[model samples]
Each structure stands twice: as structure tokens, then as C-alpha cells.
Target: MYTCAACNEHYCRRGELEKTPSNCPCNETEEVEKFKELYLQEENYKLSYNSALVEAEGYCKKTRLEEIMDFANKCDFKKLGIAFCVGLNQEAKKLAQILKENGFEVCSIICKNGSIPKEFLNIKEHQKVRPGNFEAICNPIGQAMFLNNEKTDLNIILGLCVGHDSLFIKYSEAPVTVFAVKDRVLAHNPLGALYLSDSYYKDKLHKK
Candidate 1:
């Protein structure tokens, strides 16, 4: 019942809840206080503070690439890792080159690196994108393990499939950030669905 998105009266900004709706989670002050304690940790504090500074300084002034570099530099990260889908190999290569040029040691791993077949996961032939073909399963775990072995300071996700990306993040030892998402029909920009929610894609998204 959390309806913050639908709320117009944002009382949270002023640290007050006089106008907060009935379903607002701000009413759970104890839980909020408990979670806020996490920010007191040294590492967590630096991450939260630096992330805010990055957002404030880069607002409308820098590209996402520049913002990422600024954050990495602030964090003093030297070794970076990229976990990418097979379809985005070229893009991953370009990103790797850019990171290397920026003075970061980059390690890139393809989703199909281990080359394990989908059959290992008990996936049926009918579920295959191309049936009767020897297709390799996307090994997000392998990508994370390889990067962890290399002791990467930061990990970037490039076009991993929906569930695969989650697995990679869960297994990654270092903090992870998404560089890009896969949206084949919209050139990897998934927000296209939201942008067209009231237009061409309205009927598809809001079926009556």
C-alpha cells in the first residue's frame, strides 16, 4: 500500500508527516531509524556521501560515463570489471577500452564464458530461443567468480538478461553498477515502455 509515487504532498523532505497519506511508510519511524543507522558505518557513510556529491556536482553537467568515472575516482578504485551479454560483446569491448584509457585496469567477462549448455539447468529444448541448436547458458555466476578472483574494485553490468543480472549482482564481491540493460526492441533503453505508456504502448501495458 506504499503509494509514495502517487502522492503529491511530499512531507518526507521536511522531516514531517502532517500531510502524509494513510499508507505512507513514513509512519514506521522505528524501522526508519533502524535503517538509518546503516549510514553511520565508515564505508557506508563514504559511499552515501560521495554518491550524493557526485549527483549534485554532475547534475545536468556530465554524461553518465563521466559521472561513473567521477564516482570511481572518488572511491579510489583502480581495477574494474564488466559482465556483459554475448550480444553486447562489441559494446563491452568499447567500454573496456574507454575504462583502460581512463587509467583503470579492466576485466571483461562474457555471459557465455563458461560455455555451459542450458541443459545443465534442466531447461527444456522448447524453451530455447533457437531449438535444436547447441546454445550456451548465460553464466552470471561464472562472471562474478572470475571478477572476484581478479579482485576487481568495481563491477559493471552491460546488457545481462533480467534474471542473470540479479545473479551476477548477488555473487559479485565488489559493489556493482549497471552500465546498460538489454532491450532488443528498443536498443537497450527499457524506459521506452514508460515513455510510450500513454501512447502506442498504452493498450499493451494497461489491458482492460
Candidate 2:
């Protein structure tokens, strides 16, 4: 019902409440107050304030990695955690090196930490990506629990699969941020599909 994505005017950003569409979220004054109160909480306030500063100071001037470092420094989070997919192990190593160079303690956990078989989840062999072969399930819950045990100040998710990443976030005790999403088709840049949605991918993107 909230059709803000389809709105053209974007009166909310411009502070033109009178010109806002009927379905605009700005119309919900009560909801806004509730969110405002949430932002006032201790951890929430620090995160919201520092995130706003990171956005303003780095807008169009910093890569996501740089912004993440800047935000971490602002929040005074020293120990960083990485819950990464096995497919992106190399990328995770490079990121860990960079974070260490910047003087932060790094705690890294791989998706296949436990080496538990896919059958542990009752997944049939045919359902496996490669049938008749052993497949270790991606252990998002284990990653989160390990990071939690370390008391990581912040957790970075790298290239975890869709539902797997959700499970990681759900189990993580620290503040979570996504470093990259899995999209092997587009070199992990999923936005390329959206950019082509009205052109090369029009038919593929739209449901029949």
C-alpha cells in the first residue's frame, strides 16, 4: 500500500508535506514519532547520529569501504567481525587485511565453519547444488554465534546467500552491516540488473 517508490514529486525529502501523496509514509505522524523515540535510545542514538555524519561527510566522495571505516571509527568500535561465505574467502581476507592496517581487531568466520553436511537440514541429495556429492551447509547461525561469543563490536556480512544472510543477521548480537551481497551473475553488483530492467532485462525482470 505504501507506494513511495512510485511517487514522482518526493515531497518528503523537500519538506513539502502539503504536496505529499496520500500513501506517503510522511502521512503517518504517529509512526514517525515512534521511530523518533527509537532513535533516541542509547545504541540507536549513537548509530543514527554517526551514520548521518558518515552520510553527510562522505556523500559522493567515499567508497562504501571507506564509509564503513569512518563510521566504525566514529562509533569507537574496535573489534570487527566478518561472517562471510566460502565463495568469497579471498575477498574476506583482503578486507581483514585492510581493517587490520587501519588498526582494528578482526574476527573472521567462514560460512562452512562447522562442516556439517547439508543432510543435517534434511536437504535431499538431488536438491544439492551438486547431486551425489558431499555438500556442507552454509552455517550462518554458527557464524553469528561465534561472532557473538567474541563480543564483536560490529559484524560485516560478505556475499552470503539470500536466506543465509537473513539467518546471520537474525542471530548476530552486534550491529550488522552488509559489505557485499551474492550475485555471481553480475559480478556481485546486483544493481546492474535494475539498471537494465527497462531495457535489456525488461521482460526478464517483470513477472508475467
Candidate 3:
């Protein structure tokens, strides 16, 4: 049995334990530590992932633009795709521009690309952020398909809605990186929930 000490959730090492427990026993600090040790240190991808991290850190510390260019030259990536929410179009455009300036072939797609209505999927009209206005459904599948058609080597996500991002990752053929998550309150910083856990997010705790 594999037990998640932070959650007190036991896994039989079977096909189950797909997602983390909804009700975790450990506080945010403890959870973060366990996650770092397990995912960063022991994870299979740690070797390649940590090598990139170390290289990026060293590139930032001991390199000029020329050295950085030389470092990026080693990456096999060619075409880059950016899929972003319409709300964050400006930010996405800026990011695309930066990437283009850095010599990457960039392809940017807005969330409302196909203009497919949310009602088509049987989603309640009233539940939309802009009711009565023509609202486009978040087209994660389309975004991924479009990027796949473009044959992008790498895809970057900026401000994709929580569940939609998951679908995008599932469908995408290229490797994906998240530049910004869809947390509007914390200004793209999800850790703010952990930072002020004792105060603003005290309600999150099951027992106090």
C-alpha cells in the first residue's frame, strides 16, 4: 500500500488513486514539502526536467543574450504555439511578441477561435460570464487540433480556464508549458492561497 502521509489517503497500488484526496489532512506547507520531494526528486521526469531547470537557472545567472541564445539553440523546438483566453489576449500577445523576438516561430490562437456557442454543448445560458451576449465555448479541442495541424514543437498556455487547460493538455500533440494559470484574484499566483492560508483562506481547513 502506498500512503500519502499528507492526506492520510492509502492507495493499494492498483489502478485507483488517480487523483489526490479531496480532503487532505496535512496543511499547505506540509503538502508542498511532500510534493516537492516526491515529484521533483523521485519522479521519473526529474532527470530531464531538473536538468532543464538547472540549465535555465545557470543561463539566467551566468549568461548574456548571446549565451542564452546559444543555450536555447540546443532545444529541438522550432514552431511555438500560444493558446490564450480572450480576457488575457493582451498578455498573450506580449508573450508571443517576446518569443518571436527571441527568434521562435510563434503561432497564437485566441480562445474564441471557432466562435462555437456554449449552448451547443447544453451548457446553461445563465451560467455564462456574459449572459445575453454571444459567448463562445472554450475550444480546447480545437486549440489543440489547430496547433497539431501547425505541427508546433512546443505549446504555451496563458490563462486557460482550469478544466479547459486539462483537456487541452490531453489533446495536444506537442509538449505544453503554462506561462500563466487562470487565477484572476491572485494575479496568476495560485500560491497566494497557501501564503495567507491561516487568514484569508482559513475556511479551507476542515478542523480548526
Candidate 4:
């Protein structure tokens, strides 16, 4: 029922609570109060507080990379981990190098770390991207376990596939953040489709 995205006025952002749409999420004051209290928990407090500082200080002024560094610095994280897709190995290397240069211990794991075949998941040969060829399933759980073993202070996901990223986040012991998402159709920039939803991408997206 909370349809904030459909609301054009966004009165909540302007603090005009009385002008907010009936189905606006902000109308759920009890949920808001509950989350407010939850945010004060030790782990949640650290993340929420430091993230807010990063947002305020870096708003429109700093790139996402810079803000990540600033947030890590503010959180006093000494080590970082990257769980990256095999397709984005080059990008992961560059990101790891940057983090290392910034004086943090960096550990990077590839999605195909375990060399697990798709057959292990009972995937049929016809279902394989290239039939009759070995296709390793993306091992997000292994990536998370590897990073967990490294005792990383935080984990960054570079380009994990949709469900793979979910598993990674679920298994990660440290906090996780996404550096980028996998979107082969848009050079990993999925937002491009949304930006053109009413134009070039409307039919493609709405196709049966």
C-alpha cells in the first residue's frame, strides 16, 4: 500500500506530513519509530551514523568511491574484502588496488573460486549458456566464506549476478555494500534502462 514512488509531491521530504499521500510509507509512524529505535543498536548505530555522515559530507561533491573510502575511514575499518564476478576481474583489480593504496588490507575473491560446475546444481545441458562445455556456477557462498575467513571488516560486491549476490550477502559475516551491479545489457549500468523506461526500453521491459 505504501506507494511512495508513485507520489509526485513527495511532501514527506519537505516535512509537510499533513500533505503526504494517504498511502505514503511515512504515514506508518509506528514502523518508522520501530526502525528509529533499531537504528540505535550497536552495529546498526555505527553503520547508520557513519553512512549519514558520508552522505551529508559527500552529497553531490564526492564520487561513490570517495564516499566509500570516507565511510570506511569514519568506521575505522582496517580490512576490506571484495566479492567480484569473473566477468569484472579487471575492475575488481583496479578497485582493490585503490583500496590498498588508501592503506587498508584488501582481500578479493572471484565468483568462480570453487570451480563448481553447473551440473552440481542439477542444471540441464540445454540450460547451460554453452551446451556440452563446462560452466562453473558462480560461487557466491564460497566468496563470502573466503572473505569471512579473512576476517574482513567490510565486504564489497563488485558485479555479482542477482541471486548470487543475495547468497553472498546472506553468508557474509561482515557488513556488505555493492560497488556495482551486473547488467550485461547495459554495460553493468542497469539504471540506464530505467532512465529510458518510457522510451527505448519500454517495449523490451514490458514484453511477455
Per-residue lDDT of model 3, residues 134-197, tens digit only: 8889998899999999998778888999999999999999877777789898898898988878
Model 1: CA > 4 A from native: 14-16
Per-residue CA lDDT of candidate 1, range 28-144, in tens?
889889879988888788778888999999999998888888888898889999999999999999999999999999999999997899999999999999999999999999999
Q: Between candidates 1 and 2, which one is better according to TM-score?
A: 2
Clashes of each: 0, 0, 0, 0
Query: TM-score of the candidate numbered 3?
Result: 0.70
Highest TM-score model number = 2
Q: TM-scores of the models, in the given order?
A: 0.94, 0.97, 0.70, 0.95
Q: Which stretches of candidate 3 lie over 4 Å from their true place?
A: 1-56, 59-72, 204-208
Error of 1 at 89 (Å): 0.9
User: Residue 130 CA error for candidate 4 (Å)?
Assistant: 1.5
lDDT of each: 0.92, 0.96, 0.74, 0.94
Candidate 2, residues 64-102, lDDT tens digits: the string is 999999999999999999999899989999999999999
lDDT of 4 at 203: 93
Scored by Cα lDDT, where does model 1 land? Answer: 0.92
* Per-model root-mean-square deviation over C-alphas: 1.4, 1.0, 9.1, 1.4
State the lDDT of candidate 4 residue by residue for 48-79, as single tens digits: 99999999999999999999999999999989
